[model samples]
Target: MELYNWMVEPFQTGFQIRALLGGLLAAVMSSFVGVWLVLRGMSFFGDAFVHGVVPGIAAAVLFEFSPFLGAALAALVMVSLLELIHRTTSLKEDSAIGLLFVGMMALGVVLISRSDSFQGSLTAILFGDALGVSWADVQMQLLFVIGVGLMSLMLYRPLMSLSFSPDKSQALGMRPQLTHWLLLLMIAAAVIGSFQAVGTLLVLGLLIGPAAAAALITRTVPRMILTSLILGMISVTVGLIFSYHLGTAAGASMALVAILGFFLILTIRETVAAIVRRKRSTTLVEQGAS
Candidate 1:
């Protein structure tokens, strides 16, 4: 009876409800925008954006504000900074990204390391402690997810046009740059929402691997997105299960599982392609010899 009670304890905890909901939201949001990130060659941008919020998070902690607000402010600042760099500096996007990310990350580290309340929670914020999730956290996650979904739905035509070709999208009267900005903003929101549950470091895998894996398996953007959502959900669910059994952070475990899914896609695709090529090559050789 004691063992049964102990085994069921984690599930009964209020934190578990928060964690489940939060993880689900992160998975959904990450999967939604991830397809665009992969298509735009901006996978790293997701990582950069997430890491870029560290300083703001630290500041929020320092001032006793909600981490979400701080992270959002940091994201907006980074977006504006990138725009400024593009317009004013000769440094390209990659150079600007590198400079800004490192600088912000360093500042965040300093602030977090100095703040007592945020010290231990740093790990919770970074790698995620699903077991530590609160009602507020879960609610915040749901709002972001809903907001992003609405934006995507409302601007589907413009976003689709913008993604494939900026010039064409513009020709069609869609403001590609505006949509681009909006998309990045949504990505930032997703990152902030995810940061507390999954952390900055591991969120990249959630945003990248699932989408990339889906790409390998599917040809159309919608199909890719569907696959990504399914895969991301799988990762989260399996990760939660693993975390429960292994006593590890669900976020880290989920990220790892998603990465493994990426590799799994690659292996299957490569093996199938190799076999088809071999068969074709052998048939051609036999015909030639005959």
Candidate 2:
């Protein structure tokens, strides 16, 4: 009975229920978009996209506007700016990403430094307030996840091609530039939708961690995405449980769990590979000696 209560007590509250739902939606949404970022080697872009929205969100808070709108608008501008700078200047993609990421984050700090409202909300913005998530927030998360999933289904083949081979995709008339922009838009949408659940600073953890873990174990794109989604869900659930029992921050806990999952998988994969190599060497040596 005590064990049952321990398992079921945290979920008896409305806020906890809402937080769980929000986390689940965030998990699903991040998995779909994150797998592509991992395959494209654009995890840095995803991180930049996450931080790039901070200024917009801070401005929105100051002016009493929608954080999601501000984040989306800012993210689009950042993506366009990255493309523009990369195209016109001698700067590389990583250089542009670093410049924009640090500049925007610093700008956000400056903007927030002037406003008391931002000061109060700063922790929530950076690490999230999962306990404060409302049912409306969950609904929004659900809609975004569904929309992202539909887009992934519709654009799977082209997006996959673009991730695996952009030059070949362009040669096949897939319009690599347009697909690239679309991916940027997808990343922006994901970040905006997720900021409330995991915050901007930790959003990259949810976005990259599960997909990276799945990549080590899966050979195909679809399987990788599915496995990432499952792993993400597990992370959310386990993190929520830990947060409830230990009174830890829910968003950070979730992100940390996802990252831990990635490292755990990586370690297991490396160990397995090493064991296989050792066994193969031993077998060859024995055969030669015999």
Candidate 3:
């Protein structure tokens, strides 16, 4: 009973309940987005999107506006620029990402430095404040999940085709170009939806870690997404509980746990593969000797 109370006591509070809900919602939404990011090899694009939103959030803080709105706008602008540069210029994808990432992050720093009002919330913007999440924030995250989920379902076929073979998708009349833009929109929504829970800086861990872990264990896309969601939820729940008991930063704890899950899965998978390979090699040598 003492142990149960120790584990359950923090969630009894209103703020902690809100934090749990917010984190869970963010986790589910991010896992779905992370699956696509991992499949499409767009992890760098996700990272760029995460940093691109920083300037918008900084501006929002300075003006006392909605951070989500600012983040969405910034993400849209960055994605558009990336698309334009990649399509129109001779620069490669990596160059475009590097150029935009540094520029946006530097702009955010400049904007924040110029503002005195943003000092109080600067840490929260960079590192997140899960405990500070409010009911309104949870509501917004719910809307984001619903909207993004519906869009993903509608565009599932085209997105899948684009992920595996853009040329083939184009041949199938799926218009890979349009699907690509829609994917960018979905990524932007996911990043903004999760930003308040995990912050822009550590958001990549939440976005990529669980999906990477799930991919190693699951064979199909749906299974991978489901597994990723489970991993993400567990990470948030355990991280929050540990943070409450240990008096640590909740957001950082969650991000760390998610990353730890990826590494744990990787280690287990590699070990199993090594054992299987050794067995096969032994069998082959015995047959040759026979």
Measured by lDDT, the strongest candidate is 3
In candidate 2, position 279 carries an lDDT of: 100
Residue 69 CA displacement from its true place in model 3, Å: 1.6
Model 1: per-residue lDDT, tens digit, 123-204? 7667867667788888888899999778767677788888789999999999988889889987987788787778877888
Per-candidate local distance difference test: 0.83, 0.88, 0.88
Per-candidate TM-scores read: 0.91, 0.95, 0.94
Candidate 2 lDDT score relative to the true structure: 0.88
| Worst 10-residue lDDT window, candidate 1 | 4-13
Write out the backbone clash pairs for model 2: none
Off by over 4 Å in 2: 1-6
lDDT of candidate 3 over 1-290, digit per residue (tens): 99888878879989999988988888888887888899999999888889999999998988879998899888878987988998899999989999999999988888888787566567888888899898999999999999888887888789889988999999999999999888888888888888788888877887899998999999988898889989999999888999999998888999899999999999999999999999999999999999
RMSD in Å for model 2: 1.5
lDDT of 1: 0.83
Tens-digit lDDT track for model 2 on 1-290?
99888877878878888888888888898999999999999998888888899888888887889998988878877887888998899988899999999998888777777788666677777888788888888888888888888888877878988987989998888888888877777788778888898888888888999999999999999999999999999998888888999999999999999999999999999999999999999999999999
Each candidate: RMSD: 3.2, 1.5, 1.7
Model 3 CA lDDT for position 226: 88
